[model samples]
Target: MIEQKVIINLTDENSNNLGTLTVSSIDCKNCNESRVRISNSLELINIPVVDSADNLTPIQYCPDIGANFANLMFLEETEYQILFESSDACASYDVLYSLTKLNENYFKQFRFSLGDNKTYKIAGTLNFRSYVGKSFLDIRKNKINSIKIPIEVRSKKMDYFNQYSSMIADLSHHALSLIFEVNSPLYQEFELDSKEKKTYYEDFMFLEYLFRNENLPSIFEYLSKNIHSQLKNRTEQVPLSLASNFNQNSLKNIVSKPNNLYKYDADFEIVHKLKGHIPQMIEQTKHDDTIDIPENRFVKYFFESIRDLIEKLLLSSDEGYIKDKLLFFSNEIEYYLSSNFFKQISPMDYVPFNSQILQKKEGYREIFKYFLMMEFSFRLSWDEINNQFKGFEKKLSELYEYWCYFRLLKVLNDLSITKVDFDDVFKVKKDNWSVSIKKGENSVKKFKFILYDNEIEVELFYNLRFSKNSKYESYSLAFKPDYTLLVKIGEHINYIHFDAKYRSELEIADYYNVFGKSDKKLNEEIDKRDSLEEKESIFKDGDIYKMHTYKDSILKTEGAYVLYPGNKTEQFFESDMIIPSVGAFSLTPGNDGVDENNLENFIREVLKTLLFKHGLINLNWKSLDK
Candidate 1:
């Protein structure tokens, strides 16, 4: 008999059950029947035969599992073949409509519980296909609407997710990965809109962190570190041909000058454009603008002394020692800049790449403050502060030239040790989408930065390093997830890793295996990292947060999500969240929240670096208080 315990008996013909037998079933190969619906029925007889009025037992109650039974889960009509009739065999099978598969990549699964049923037949299995290829995020197609006009053109927005497990991931990584795993394919076979494709592009940038999805882990190397945070992948496309159809010249124009394509610049674009200029010019200009800043003299002097620091770092340490020093500088500078800022400047002022101010800290501070305050007053006096502030302004900005070099240095450092894979392919209308990935005539300001020390020699070294060793198609796949947060509730803690989720659900075996585990299982993986760094960095504090991405809704499952940093969010998300933010990095920056590429090795390196240099950078990247 088939049951919650196990299937015991199988026979090719129903007549073989002369009386009744209960045996354990283990081998499928030896079974003679193609498939059989075994029954485990417990009987209730008439001891007194009563209705509720008198409290007597009913007559002959041998119940068959009905709709209220596990029957609803078994959409296959023949699932209750024996209960329906012994000789009934339908010519075709019923489309097991409501059966939902788990939202996974390689380990895709479909399941329905025996909610109230007792007996059910195993139906035929369907071949594998992508849900991304089948659904759309339609506002008009309400849940009440049905595609009854089957003969008419049948189109759909992809189902970004596969199932409705009550988990609303809070971290960007978990959220992005969910969407990434759930995103459906946009193919030439379907007739989709230009806007939809544009939405896809925008989502790709924010969620998957990839501007283009022609291939997995595509090189977005030419993009700037500044633009990395806010480069919107908002390109619209109507499919005409495959990727080859994308005008290379158009792309070149797109990369060289994205400003020409858009209607207006948001905070992100302004930063990207300003940073695109020569590092020297950009920083000098920024410095001049911030002359009135409280620590102006200190900052300027720091900039002046940047060269020595770079030399010290370069000479004192080669490839191995640079990471910690870099992290220290990256953290210290960012904290100092963001924390101490009296006023918010343009996006250009927030570049994370800059040289270290290694020596004579006090003198540098004095010089910087004097020049900064003096410049502030000078700029304020002018009616308009455009081209009028050239000459000395340019020279002042020259002090910051080293940041460009540092930005390049970071990119090269990223490239030198990291390995990424783009085995997967995404087919969609080709369009020009760009970022600071450092490819296709990408520029410094476009992919540049501003160091706190603001030194030229350091800038020069970074510039030379990147210009020489780095590819223009700079590893676009390198996504710096806005943040990695850890949240705790009830019995478990969730590590929310954020990244971009570009494509919908494909084949993700590992993702399913990891996310599907219970609380006990999740802790095991955390404790058993292959490296101490991964163990400490990833599990103890936090790691690169690649948010899970999704395809809104599709067949089988309604809303599905997959986490890139499939740590522990799987345990509590929807089960607790009454309403959750679907936006990527909703907890931090770039909150679009869905798409999918977070490099595996890149994640490891992030954890390793973060743990190795705990004191170097200041961040809340730590594990939940479990």
Candidate 2:
């Protein structure tokens, strides 16, 4: 005797069941057998039989009765499988399944049909290498019942949710502010023409931020209440008999003839026959109070444009929270546009700088301010902005690289570093205010300070490249570190390079394990490498040896280090020498925020060594050349 039941199992990389799977039986009026649907066209056949309790046994026993949401914990870049089985043999069945990322634009679908088989298996690799968030798997049976399983994807490399997300958000926010601080030259070139302005990612981000702002609702309400109006005069034709007032120009239309006038008593006939002609119509001027001023027209145009933008974002966004917010803003804009106040205003072309009401009125003033900001947002085309940082949002490595740039800036600023020259740090290009830093360019920031009566000139470079064809040529091959700092005291100059590694210490440890060694042992071995080929191989693999490559290949390099988001900081030094060294520094974002003390202390130590301990340079520094 076979028991009527069905079972589905979800397993991890090792083919171990994550949890128990259960299914409930639905009654079929025409059939006595119980059936369960698994996935696309896949159904379980159950044969009913009566037997003694002692002799009866189930094919697969499940403690749970009905299907329930299962929690599946997934590691990024791992493989997993789903297995389906029934108590009895089934002729044919189809199954439909899909994995969808919650609130993100990612999904994968799978379909399978089995014939004359009681079991079926589906296998796939789940690669959330660059993302960590909530997702779900949906399995449908017979196209009637759906079983949804929730999945939590996590990164084995770093603290992706709290640390990575927070750091990226902070970096993106700062980058956005920098972009806003600059007025694009394109705006001046285009002459503020709407047709010429193109929307970019920054513009969308700004609009999203603007719509979510708490002050926006109050601004709209205030503008709606205190709308400005102007008196408009319009000319219309009216009958001559109905004209209340007549001027000399209007009176000329009536001919002066004796027969033209007819005098009669209250009910008597006319005394004289008709005249030659009489004017049938006259032009009259009418005055009306209209909210058709430039300010009002601009307000209408702004709302309409914003509403359209909201709709566009809505179509592109899949996140529930973001969609909800967009919908709310869209509805609010729609309501305002359809309101009596806005309906009274007529649509007109956006006339730049023609609104006194916007300039003087309190509510309109705020709208005008944002309108100007919006104009700046529109100046940069999407292609240009995208080219600046390709895949910035999707790739965590790219995001981490940019974040390190800004984070280092904050650290330097916190140390009271004063600018000696501002030309390369920040500048106005054409009409746009922008940071001077660009990938593959010599973006430098120079600072000077007096230490022990010696003037130290510090130059920090971002994404500085060294090549055979460049001024600072590499001895072996071209290599570009994320940041390079040069310190000049008198005639001697020292260079230190830093590379931002997105991999955490744990990942490095795992990589070393593949070679049957621990990270500490590998580091020791790396320091002992004598052959150039070994060093070149490690550098090609992009391990800690890359730091070695920087220190060895770049001329005058004192120290080369790795800046990673990890908990441990490892520093190594050459025998009897501190200046020539290689190490990794922990510079990760924490719950409270990034703790720069580790990196900051190391930098101060390096500066101390450079300034005070460099061959009596500090002792006679007062007499050294500037």
Candidate 3:
């Protein structure tokens, strides 16, 4: 066997060099077992087995060094790659790598042998140093004798962190854009005052014309038709003090100074009697931009509401670069709120003389519009935000699921067998992200499709409960599937289960043998192994296994299937009288609708079987019995 030596270059999260690790193969007699020992005191701190099964096998590209097999070592004089085995076979644990004490007495053994004095170098660089679990060996062989080898080591936890952080950034920017843009009616109304103030004379003339319109109340008729007409015919521009010509003292004496003079004692008695007979009325006025108006409160409230929401989202998230990005945006929001630009605007206040006038009031209507836009930004409703930030993360997944549900509904609607009646509950809260179906009310959480003409009911539930206990047994366990497409005809209920596996991954093999399998024969051997293994590893082991358990445990369930994101149309797996399928379809988001060919074809096939069973179609089904 070729003699091999490994050098692990440790780096920080930023890829800055910390130190290098070097371990030499130990002298062992076993031809199959390879042993190596680390002689440095500042080398590896610890080797943690992150997989729950504790089988730290090297991945396809990595060598079978002593790191994987307890009784073997790869002491070959060639380049190597280090990577961990597939995670599906192991019980899941935290995928974190912790740095351990790099002391002496670190001896390792592998089920291989090495020839003497051959200097084979296998180097790798692992990024991120939060040492908690075992690190895998990733390496490959190449003819180019490069001095340094570079490999990116990413933990699953970090992957999730990156994905989740991206989602938060996307939503934060969206919310901020909505808040800053002045296109909403509320902002437009606020701008109207500035425009009128810039050209008051022109605006007053326009207002005169507007007030004279037949749509206005009778109170403004004289101001429109009589006074406006008189002003318009004068050709000359009116003086700025035009209002000074009118005598206001007479009106004040009649309205504000009623008791200024009493001509006689009888006059005083009569005035007192008239005052006592007049009714006292208080006008309750509402306005936007006023200190006391609730609409004016929206300014500070808008800033405060979103600030609190983003802060909550930030606090709930794991502290990372993503959190820092959110913090930066939050600070930006604060700056915008406290800036002189926002402060210069005065609050709007007005009393509507007519009850319907507020709706016509541009400034007032704008305030309401602003309220709605802000509410939408925070996904806030009357009582709760309903975890709006988190909900946005699920938006893509939920959209796909809902599309699938509706697609199925359309199929049933098109069916000639039964007259379809479909009803769904879609509700949005007053100002929040508390948009959801009213649960516990006639299957509100699920899409209800009832065919009254044919006595068939099909209920498509979205993450709804199937049973509180196992359907196969009486165990008390809640079984909530992502979607339970239940079809009921007469007295029988048939269930076809589906789950949306958004992140199921297929394995990629290193056929080029960049990782030490340079020999053509050896490369072909590994390829053969991979091809055979593909049968058992078609889908993610955990996801496919969960589907099987769901199918077997659910009573009288016809078939259980998984809807994953991939290009393949479908893949079926048969197991012990139970046939569960794992299928793929392109359920991505775009301006256009979903690419429905793959999913639609599958649904059509299933419908054909159902229709035949119900005697709605003329096809024979004796083959189905087999």
Candidate 4:
């Protein structure tokens, strides 16, 4: 007698497990097994009975695990498989698709009960794939839509997510390191006023915590501080004065009589003759050197300047988070200055870069230099600051496109299928897909790469202006695509364009509808919709429509797609086969790397088709599958 058990892992379109099933050896052998189903309503039906047949292993059955099975999530077909062994032979099936949902807008609600009678609502897409007992399904909580597709595509999109998450971490670490290296000397200069200096130290640590993804210690306390406050404590150490020597009645420091009346104090402290009403004297008058105590005098100003510069150079744009930080530091500095501890520092109190005052106060020389560097060194204006902050997303989007380009390059390099002929390969390679990871500051406004050999030519353009010269003059407006790839093989050429979209699902859904309430209220609306409509798209119509316009209007274009941060099950979409089409690639990241994504497979498939079509490779194309 052989004893066996079968377990079916039920998952959604994104391959998130809805439930798990275990059956006995008798159920495995039964050819006409009872059908199990999970509807879009998340209702579980006809679950297999536990221990109907003899149990070989001391395995628990449905009575133990399936008692609370009503809460299983559902999107599409509930797939399962059989696993059994006898003395003679063992057997397994590829995949069994049983349960399914037919409606797209049907309501699906799965109640997951935690301890203490607490339950949570989860939104997900439906996905199906081959089962090999290896955990390939990884699902993330939906922030937009909940309709899942096949598992292979979902896995591919997960790859993009991993790559992006890793890149963001690297950039943040770089920023944090730069902040510490540039601001340490400036911090030490304020050692005379330790009370105020400590506030700066706290602010720096808070920024560090933000980078580390730790909870902020005092968020409300930090934001409540005033940014633009007046300085109060100050003293006039050196009084400014004026002097005169040739006055009659103002003879205060005269020790000798005048030698000549005409040539008064020129020749003689010795007297020759005294003229009528002649009185030789030196007079001096004093005045207070008053100043308004400039707003940018605190050590916090130094930190804010550095941060602003870093954001200007690297980040896409600050979402007023930096302003809140500035407020915290400004309030702390104002408090410190209001006290009797530190001397009031006016704008004139700041020593010039090469002033002899630096020689006298050597301790404050570094401090002066730090100030000069912060204010005068970069000369960044308010307009520039605003521009940099607003353009932060553009930079990040461009970086993602570059990441994709480099990944492709790596794959090509590994295959030894490409001989890259960069634009300036002969001299210095000026026009190429290049990344300048500069420390402290960096600029890449106009950057791109061009590749060519004897057979194939590839142009990877970044932020290429869509003007009349490029034949993209549709609306007489300036439009620059994030990334454009133009490939040429002999006489045949193909253009595939890509645009990086760093939008969340909620954002995409909101884009579909013009007017909306506050994000908080809109979120409530989205949650309610998720329970009702399981298969509806959470994507914005504009995003896909823009891609369609790109492919249709842009000259020499074959296809256009948007690479976004969505967790959709299907990695790619195509509306038409013959005409150029548009689609999207959900590349948002999760914690770990992709488990079994098909992004690589899809790229390979596309490449193989193009290679064969252009006669670049001459082999049995079908054999490439092997």
Candidate 5:
């Protein structure tokens, strides 16, 4: 095994050394160069491994170190300079250093000269102010030696994994529950043991069900109370004189064969046939109570299966918060496993059928039903979504968009907006009956809202695309908004556009400077900016500009809004007209509950304005009569 010493020095913005990390390289083949054949085209591509030392020296790249390698940890929104030094570097080698953000596909390469004309040393500054995840750093010295190191970036404000995961969980639960309630054909053909085509969605849904139903605790409690036991029969060799129920068989065996008889306490006995037995013995039948029933075995099997699944998920997960969350779940599962009841029961190879005990017993019945329903419940995948968006490495941008859509739907539903049908939103594929929700402009959901005896129709669109090629296109350039809402009353129509921004902050002036302010007042405010300390802004200015474009270009657009995970909401109006407005609303996933009051209120206000403007509701009415 070829071993190499690698030293990494981490420094902050002030050039103060934060810490140092020492990493060791492991040996592997094809480390210098490798060929990869594309699966689709079957075309071979030669990938040259950049080496930092001699061209003849083999490189030892460690790709199996996992996503969140402990050797490299960084805090979000922090700037740090990293210096890489390797003992195997040659004096004449020129180093090429590359850094790539795997999630965003951002790459930067730098060339380094020999450090002090002695060893190969490369340094770079990484600014993790925008996003957080795993990034790869590749150091190569011509054809000599190359090493790839994995870096983990983490958020300093909140638990990134838990927050995003919670959002996705809530959104998926709502969507999947709707699918289940409507009896989608996705659940028709269920196979329990077909593990080849499973996704993380299935794993999450199963875990959610178990936690939501409190199945584990309930099963434990029920088994503790109504402990099930069964009579087990066993046969043992004993003295023929002492055998109680060994009537005909024992007596015939002892009397027919004289050699079988032996001297006993006071009577003749059968001779022992095996070691560790009395001198003369006979077969005896014995009955005893055992808790190792099939039902108990099933319980053990369920717990062990769930524990293994959780452990697998933990290993595969790259997010620290998710690993911690999974650890908590694993601990909860261990509570059931450590119980004496389960310890006494043996493991089961196959799931048992629903027998009388499984069906009739209170505790056993519920768990058994859950076990049977597990495969059917989560087997369906989101067929319309891309495969990349289905697993743990799901894009937060796409997830936030979906979460915003579902959250808006929930808000509308909470406000008494009745959906027309699920036909457009949910469809079953003809090939496999897998459920798919139509995305983009092809999918539209209609709802009806009645206020003051006026029936108003509303349409919701997810990822609505406006194309210049269309005959009825309103925008000069093609654009796709995350969500679009259309309200219709008689001949009047209004369109409201919303874009989900996964940012946690936005740049904005005070209310007076942004809304209902003249150009002169804004100019005066800008002039005084030098004296006023500016607030740190993480939101992109282009997002606000995009909202303006949506409002200005899209015909009949009453409002264009940005939904972000922030704590403040701001709205900007065009002149004095409420119809032409641009704004951003705070719509974030809450640790306790969803923080959507601002968005909800804004949506309600929009509906009220539309109803009032269309003469559907009385102007004097303070609120809609629910």
Candidate 6:
């Protein structure tokens, strides 16, 4: 082991005169443990560790020290380091030198052997304070063999710059107010008025047009259309046998003698009338290929006359208006072949043959239409109307749309408006195709359909087993549908499909044929693409049919209806089915054309069918009448 005998001989060379150090150690310490015993004491003196082959042991760095540490001492083994440190110490004397404590209780009593004659020379200018937990100490000679053992210090405080920067920011705030030179990189993220921002699909009409002409980009494109067609087709195919009831025209006339036909409520009028006069028109059993319903006299006649027209209105036209409105929504333009659509489907005419006051009120139509005409006149930039008429136009628009649902109610009234004679309006017999299951009453895993908010979420981490082709990307985002269905008629579970669409349009090209030539993404949207069969086949197959079926069912279903803030109802081709104006539902039930009671009944039936326990009974659900 290398022994260090350090002696501090003070001669008072400079100021800040502190203390001295002396060493008396040749003690036979253990060879293995990292320790050294020393016998000498000094104030304002430091003994530090340095790096060198012969100077220190243990090559790893240790950082645990502070500046201004007192009673400083370094135990040198030259092999192992067992540095035991205590500070704020009292002192004792060596054989000749008097010692005073410096830091902790870290002083020495072991003698220097020279009992009375000791001379140490240390300069007063060097104020040597100690530190700990450092890798190495630097020794620099200062003139006469006196050296400075540099101590590596741990920082005492952080936040030296923050205190100064705050003052500058305060001054800037007072001087510039809101008109400061915004020079920060974060300034590019300026806030925008979210209400004024354009919608993601502001040009949704263009997408609608493109979708009608071009084939879709996925396997589920036609599913919705096919589903709608199937449903409508099945509805049209229903047998039209009249119910068992007496004719009500004469009864209506008899009741009208008091000018109170509008409020007429005859639950048993037909039965009362037929007791003696029309006995043959009482009971007649009818049979179709699949059904058996009794024919009522009055109900039969009432429906028989308009059954064809109602069915034509219901089943014939592909497009339809909400009761009386001019708003239209359809898959194909051919379905839009009715009246002038939104422009002509005035909302003032359908005042219920009952609100005779509103019906008899003739100029009401002009008043109602004048404001809408003027507003639209100004909006579409047709004939320039004076801005002074703005207030009148707004008021008329309000009364016409509020007090009278001209376009809406009329379209609903105009719906293949058939009156089915029920045994009881509230109680229809259970001839349902299948049992209705409420949520949790049935198994979620066994559902025929599933809808999720994130199609990508399901495909990733969830590990859904579906392959991607040229037509649709594996991680493509699907529609955020309002509802999901799980129908299981027959063993058609193999018809598993989904409908995923974007509100935005993507002009997808034939990746199959054109991809072979260049293998790049095509930019433009083509109207007709007979040019790409194999690529388009993905979207044209039975899979797509299944998906579209589910999609269309959800789209047209009562709960999953589409809505907008500015939509309007219109008569496109037929009756009330086309009445999905901006914020209301349409009434177009299956088999029997929709009527007053049918709306409620259809809702209850759909709620049951949808398996949702929460039905739409209490909801002040706005109807096409709105």
Q: Compose the digit string of candidate 5's lDDT tens values, residues 45-146.
A: 222223211111212222343432322444443434445554435433322233332432232224555355444455544454445544444444333334
TM-score of 3: 0.38
How much lDDT does each candidate structure score? 0.23, 0.54, 0.36, 0.36, 0.58, 0.23
Would you give me the overall lDDT of model 2? 0.54
Q: Give the distance in Å from residue 483's predicted Cα in candidate 2 to where it truly belongs.
A: 2.2
lDDT (Cα) of model 5: 0.58
lDDT, residue 36, model 5: 41
Per TM-score, the best of the predicted structures is 5
Clashing pairs in 5: 51-140, 51-141, 51-145, 52-141, 52-145, 54-144, 238-282
Q: Give the per-residue lDDT of model 2 (tens digit) for 483-524.
A: 998888788888898887764323444544556644687667
Tens digits of per-residue lDDT for model 6, 1-626: 43333343322234222233333233322223233233322222122332211112212112232221212233221111111111212323121111121222123222232222233222111111111111212111222222232222111111112311222222222211111124322123333222321221111211222222222212113222221111111111111124343245434433444332223234555434533222211222333341111111211222222223233333422221111111212322223222122222223322232333223333322222222222211111101111112210111111111111212222223232232111111121123211111112121222111211111000100012222342212233333332232233222211112222111111222323443544333322232332232222112222222333333432232222221111121112112332211112222111122332433343333323332222312332333122
Q: Per-residue lDDT for 1-626 in model 1, tens only?
A: 22211122222233232111121222122123233333443221111111211101111111232211111011100111111111123212122111122222212123542212333323222221212111110011112221110000010111112110001111112212212232322111223123222212122112221111221112111111111122222334332222223444444434565344434344565346645421111100111232232233334234333333333443443221122333344443343334333133232232122223212233332333333322221111111112212211111111112212222223333433332111111112224221111211221221121222211110111111112224311122332221222222223222222222222222222454455556776657644542442222111112211222321111111112222221223211332221122222111112222211122232233333333233333433343111
Off by over 4 Å in 1: 1-91, 94-120, 123-453, 456-626
- At residue 479, candidate 1 shows an lDDT of 24
Q: List ranges where model 6 is wrong by over 4 Å.
A: 1-483, 488-507, 510-626
- Of 4 and 6, the candidate ranking higher by lDDT: 4
**Model 6 lDDT-worst window of ten:** 454-463
Please give each candidate's TM-score.
Answer: 0.19, 0.53, 0.38, 0.32, 0.63, 0.14
Ranking the candidates on TM-score from highest down gives 5, 2, 3, 4, 1, 6
lDDT of 4 at 574: 49
